[model samples]
Each structure stands twice: as structure tokens, then as C-alpha cells.
Target: MLLNQVPVFIFLIILSICEAKQLLDEEFGTDDVTSGLCDDFFHGTPWPLPHDSKGRGLARLCQNQIEDGKEGRIVFATMFSTTERIPVYTANTVVLHRDGKEHPRPGSKYWYRVSLALCSSDDHTFDPIESMIGHAEKHEMEQCRKFQAVTEDYTHNGLNLDRGHLSPNSINEQDLEKQLGTFTLTNAAPQFADFNREVWRVYECVAQHTILDYVPGEKVYIITGTHGVALDVNNNPWWMNGDDTDMDKNPVKIPGVYWKAFCYPGNKTHSAWGYAIVQKNENVYRKPDYNEYITLKEFNTRGIITAPFGPSCMDASFGVFSKVFENWDEYIDTKCPSYTKKKREEL
Candidate 1:
């Protein structure tokens, strides 16, 4: 009786695995990371401009409604590097928070993977968020384990890295759905827990506050990104070691730096302005300031951030010093008194 039951269990396991593979094949038929797929999020400009992503193993996913066939509004956009197993950048327009409160973060189990299969030329389509909200089965998620980082990747990882979000949940608190949407694994990167929770959190707040306070009722685009290779918990550059094949090891490149950039389109009263911050993702314990700030042009020129605000939006005319920091008055007094003096002379 025991032997007979063992064969039945073995057969059931095979059946489940096959079903998971079939569903994945049908849903993720082709690599839809083509050019101009999510241009609306970039002010109609193709991101990572000046460099074509064709054959780069990068997947441009436009995160939309989670419900299959529901076709909900786009929550945000992400350029995922399949090779790095991390997001290059996530772009989204900052929405005004109506009540000044943040939504509760969903449980860790809610995070999602965009696809199990990397790329194909077939004619089928797979929605990035289709697996969320009860659309995917337990066996289906198990299949993703083989190809991409799952919740378990960050768990017990020797580095003790946090699953840092490119598009932070706090900024999207205006809409609960959009806030919850940031939980996808494709939108995450391995970050030092101290840096992610403390330093980076403050930077995110500064970006959100600057836009909300100064440019209310207008669309302000914010882009968060990562760069460079990070060190392991023991300070070893594991990525540099070519022969390490341990699946439990860090699967993605832990970024050495994290940056955020924003663009505010000018109206009749104001000229278009933008600001960016590139901070080292080390164990620093200080609030972000103007010292870390770099002009959007410098950000692109240095190759730290490639065309972060997009080509059409980032040009010679955009002013980096138009708005200095959070407190405009304090900034004028301490940081750049000449800016206001220059403005007065021009007027």
C-alpha cells in the first residue's frame, strides 16, 4: 500500500510541474520589452535614451492593473535588467497626497515576479502584474524560483540585504492600489538595511516633499535608480569571482550607489526645473543634502544616470538651481543668496 501511494504522489508532482510550465508558456509568450512600450511614463520619450536596449537582456515592463483582463490604470514603469536581476530604474509621476497619510504596506507574500521565462518571440502576451491578486497558482510561483529571485532570495542571504524598492511605497500612498503595486520583486534591488531604511528613506521624503509643496496640481516626474557593484557582507566582491555557482549566494548585483532625479515642467510663471541626488549606498548615517546633489546634465554626462529625465524633457534650458531645496527661504539665505540676487537683476 505504501509503495502504491508513493507512485501516485510522484505522478501528482510531475503533473503539477507540467501544469505550471504550460501556464507560464501560454502567458509569457514573448519578450514585450520593446522600444516605446511604456513611453507615456517617460513624458513620451524612450528611457535610457541614446542607447538602444535591443539584445541587451533588459525588460521594459509597464506595471499596470494586477487583475488579468481587467486593464487597470498604469501604476508605474520599470526597466528591469534580466542579467543583473535588478531594476535599472523605475519612473513614475508623483501624485498629490490628498490626506497626507501613507497606506499600510502589504505582507511580504504579496510581492510578485514579472515572468519566469526570460525572452521569446511568440505572439502571446503576459501582463506584468497578472500573478498578483490571486491570478497565479502556488505551483506557478514555484516555477519562477528557477529563473528569478523570489522572497526566499533575500531571506537568510549572507549579506542581510533589504529588498529596496526603486519606486517607494510612501510616495504612491495617494492611491492604495499604486502603493501596493510597488511590492513586485522586479522592482526591487538588494540594499543595505541601514541605508535603505534610514538614509534612503529620508532622500525619498525630500524628493516627495519638494514636488508636493512647490509644484502642487502639476505633474512632476520622479525617477529612482541604482548603479555600480556592491560588496558582500564580508566585504568580498563576490560578483568579481567568476566561478561561484551557489544558488543561495547573492543572485543580483548589489548596487554601490542609489540615486533619485525629478523634473517639474514649468508653467507661465516658472521655468522648468530639476534636481538629482547620487548617494553612496554604504553605512553612512547622515541626512542627504545639497552636497550630494548634481545637475541633471552632470548626472547624464558622468554616465551615472543615462538620460534619466528623458531627452525631450532634459535640455540646456532646464534649470537645476531654479528651486534649491525644501525650504526656499532658508536655501536663499544660506545656500545660494546669489541665485535670488541674480533673479532680481534679471527682472
Candidate 2:
């Protein structure tokens, strides 16, 4: 169908359907994330989804209501794993907090489940979305519970797991609707309390502050995700040996490692640069130390990360860069010493 000739509302509907087809196509997982799908949120160089050999992961364009009462503005994109009931990764360009003000958290019970009916539509020739694009109905939610994690999975389960967000709320605090978009259960994983509230939070802050402080107007794309699966205390340990999780027995897969990658696309003035960091999921009280941060080369060496920013900015390696740039004020100086020297020469 020719979309331009249709009414604006009809155009939107058709566009959404086309997007769904593109996102859910079987080959979408194998394609680079920067394949022009939701380029606005990805900054034209989105990170690729982690490998899902079982084909349980689905690509979703998360949307929320805008000022015009329309609900299709793409907030971010995620590769949600239906089997593990958590997002493998969420790729989004940071939307800085408005005027240094953070949005207050929403009331309790704000989580929503992805619409299983739409995701698992039998008429389509693509992988099922498992409802990350829309909210599921009561009956649909029940059916989804068989393969997806539900709100109840995190409640009173005797596991000290917090619903950790892949796409954090603080980065999107400027827009209430965008912040709320991060509350979906499909966008979360079972995170340890200490790790989630402590070091992981610090990592998120550093990534956000890196953009807000030094590179204020630059587009900084971030991809946060899980690496390995954690064993459930009550469930069989052998099940955790592989990527696949037994959803009926243990629906939520606590991630063994959490990682974040960020890219700053430089303009004509300077070249592009990006970094990645990883941390174990176990309890760690203090802030993340320098060694936790690594270059994209090291990230790929450790495995799971896929694709780079087209052989330029994304490919530049930080060979001997500092492990941690404690002060954001000195980030450009300490983190990018060579770049700093170049800037000094230009001055």
C-alpha cells in the first residue's frame, strides 16, 4: 500500500504495520541494528542484538504517547527474549534530563507486559514479538506467562532480584512518557539488589554524565544488556549451563553479567569514539573501578557484542586509556589523552 496518499492517521497505522514486519522478520536478528529501523533513537548506528540461537529474542520498537495523544513515537528499541523474560539488550540515544531536574518515580504497579497476541500473530512470517510493542490483555497475559516473565515472577519469589532496566529511566527523565516506557517487564531482568542499586547504578550515571557534562549536545548512543544466565537457587543448576531457560520451571533468568556500551559520534572536528564496560551480577557494594571499563575491542574479545559503527568512530580503540575517569570534568582530558592533546594543538 502507498502510504503517502492515505490520511495521516491511516499512514501512521500502515507505517506501524510495516515497521512491525521489518522488526519481526526472521533475518532482522542477523542484520545490523543500524539497518535504518528507528534510526532516530539509535543515532544511525545502533548496536546489534546479542546472539539468540534458539530464536527466542524479538526486536521491538518501544513507543509511548506524545503531546498530540498519538502513541507511536519510538522511545527506544530492544531485543526482548521471550524465553528468559528479559531484554537481551536495549539500544537508545540518551535523552538528557531537562534542566537538571529528574522525574519522580511513578506509583507502585506501573509495570506492563508486552502484548503476546500481536507479537505471536500467526499470520506473519517473522519471529513473535512476545508483546513488547503493546500491552497484553488478561487472558493473553496468562498465556504469555508460559514463556514470558510476569510481574508476579519478581514478587515474593525468595530471590533478591530487582527488576533491573536495560534502558534506564534517568536518561529519559525529560519526558514523562518516555520514562514510563522503560517500565515494561519485557525491558527488565532479574537483577541483584546490591548490584542494581550500587555499582550498576554508578555505571549508568557515568554513561549519562559523560554525555550530559562533557558532550552535552553530541549524540551518545548506548546499548545496555545481559551476558550470561544465572542459576536459580531452587531450580536445577544444570539448567543454567546454557543460554536457554526453562520458562515453566524458572521463568526469570537472572543475568550473570551486565554490560553497557556507548558511542559518541564525532563531527567533522573530531573522530568518533565509543567504550564498553562489564560487571558481575553478584553483590558489590562500592562504585565501579577503572578496570571494569573496557574498549570495544575488549568487549568483542569477551564475546556477545555484535557490529560496530561502520569501521570509523565505532572502531577506534582506546589501547592504553585510563580504566576510570573519576571526575566527569576531567573525562575528556583523562579518558582521551590523545584527543586532549590534539584539541590543545588546535587551540
Candidate 3:
């Protein structure tokens, strides 16, 4: 019996060593391992379900009526149909705010964009429904008319910015209904054509590909929005195109920067690996790179995200996959040559 017990002890010791090594790997740098996990950030708070004054949680193309003090509110749009009835797309909607005609600032905790999910499995294939596109346009027109009647604000047309969809159509390519839902003007915001088509487009593709490759079967939650005062080429805040007197005639506001955050919850090993990326909405073309990724702590510190992203659905350790790049040292050297040289000399 003692001899048999010795083998069990040996096995336990080996297992402990392996676990320790993995932890060390995460601590130092390991792209595949989960490095950060902050589960207590939410403090038992529940996810905010989308709703409006009328208690209508889900509306196709309607805008939520903002209360006098309330700057913004979220309203659900559509859900992705999955085989398991998992309801993978709750809180998958837009956050509307009131402010300017070219750029809008959502009040604290309000998303000036949309958040949603996409699920794909080996057996499932997503395809867009061409017919639904027309239907979606009709809904937008009707909703715009209703908005005009209630607020008398100008419609979302005749702007220099493109009607960029917060929840992009490409994300829901697997489901026709979800794809169509993205077309609603309510789900869009004014965006510079160059920024939208160039910088932002690349980032979106990288984000989508990262999830698909890392967690093939699980659902990925993507929260996207805009923030900050729009900037002119000279880096000054670009307010309404014309004087404030005519501002009421147009209410759309352009954004200075666009942001996206994503989380893959099924990776139990690295459940805290949430990430957020921000790109300037300008014409200067820069390809999406890993350096753009920042930790959730850094994101909050920079004032990019002010809301409490908690209750563990999004976790606390949200940020970039820090260990993915092999030349981090070299990259830093190039950016800060003096600093790198100083550190190396001291070492």
C-alpha cells in the first residue's frame, strides 16, 4: 500500500510543477495563456438590459427618447438565431444620445454606438438576405419620419460623413435577420469616409479573425462605440459645420475616435482576456497593428471608456494579447531609442 501511495504522490508533484510553469509563462509572456482576470469588477451587478421610456426593449429602427437629465439610453434591435436557443445576442443593440448634428457625446455610461455578438460553428454558415435590405430601408424612413414628428430635428441625410453602422453588417454574415438589422440608420453614426473605409475596416477584420481563430465554436461579444470631440486637420475640435444658430436644423455629430471591445467567455483558462481598440477618425492612413491594443486599465486611465464594465460578462482584465508579438523589445527600441539605450546601458 505504501509503494502504491508513492506513485500517487509523484504524480501530484508533477502536476503541481506543470501548473506552476504555466502560471510563470503567463506572468512573463505567453500569447495563448490567459494573463489577466478581474472577475470582481462588476460586484454582483446585473447586465443592463436595453429599454426605453415606453418599456419597449426591442425596436427595429426606433430611437429611445432621452429624458431631460438622461443623456442616452440603449435599445435592443435583433437577436441571432442559434441552434441551442442560447439567446447569444441579448443587449445586442444601439445606445442613442442627444447633442450635436455632426458629433454626439453620450452621457456617462451611455454607449454612443452598438454592442452585439456573432456565433459560428462547423455546421453553420451565415449568408445575407438581399430582400431584407429593402425592408430595412423602409423601416429607417418610417422611424425617421416618427422622430421628425416628435422632435422636429433634421433627418440623418445630407451629411458629409457616411452613415457608418456601429454594429457592422459583416459581423452577422451567418444570419440574414441579423445582417438586415444592421442596416437601420438608428444603428449608424456620422463617420469620416476615409477613416471608416480604411483604418476602422482593417481593425474590424483583425478583431473578427482573432475570435474565429481562438474560439471557433463559442459566441464572441463585441461592444463598439464612438467618443471625443471631432478634430479638424489642424487637431482642433471640429464642432457643427456652421454657426450654432443653424445647429438645430441638423443634429448629427461626428466623432473624433471610434472604439471596439471584444470578449470570448468560453476560454475558461483565460477568461479575463478582454480587449479594446481605439482608432482616430482622420484621413492619415495607418494600418491596424498590435500596438493599438491596450489593457482595460489603460483604456479607463485614458478616459476612452468611462462606464463600469463589470459583473464578469466583460471581466476586469480587458486588454490586448500582450505576449503575441515576439519583437516587443525591438518595437519599443525603435519608438524610444534613447530610453531603450539607457535601459540597456544600465543593465
Best model per lDDT: 1
Write one digit per residue (lDDT tens) for candidate 3, span 1-347. 99989999999999998999776444322212221121111222222221111211112222222334332322332222121111112224221122212222223222222221111122212121111212113334433332211112223433446656677765554444454445444455557666776667766655554444455545555666655557666766664332356544434445567777565444456555667777776655565466788655565555543432553534456323454345544543443233224557899
- Per residue, candidate 2 scores C-alpha lDDT tens digits across 185-256 of 767888888788766776776676656655665666788888776654555431221333434344567788
List per-prediction Cα lDDT, in the order shown. 0.63, 0.62, 0.43
Please report the TM-score between candidate 2 and the true structure: 0.71
Candidate 1's displacement at residue 120, Å, is: 8.4
Ranking by TM-score: 2, 1, 3
What lDDT is reached at residue 3 by model 1? 88
TM-score of 1: 0.70
Decide which is better by lDDT, 1 or 2.
1
Please report, as a residue range, the 10-residue window in candidate 1 with the lowest summed lDDT. 116-125
User: After aligning candidate 2 to the native by TM-score, how far in Å is the CA of 244 from where it should be?
Assistant: 16
Top candidate when judged by TM-score against the true structure = 2
Q: Give the Å error, residue 179, model 1.
A: 0.6
Error of 3 at 315 (Å): 5.3
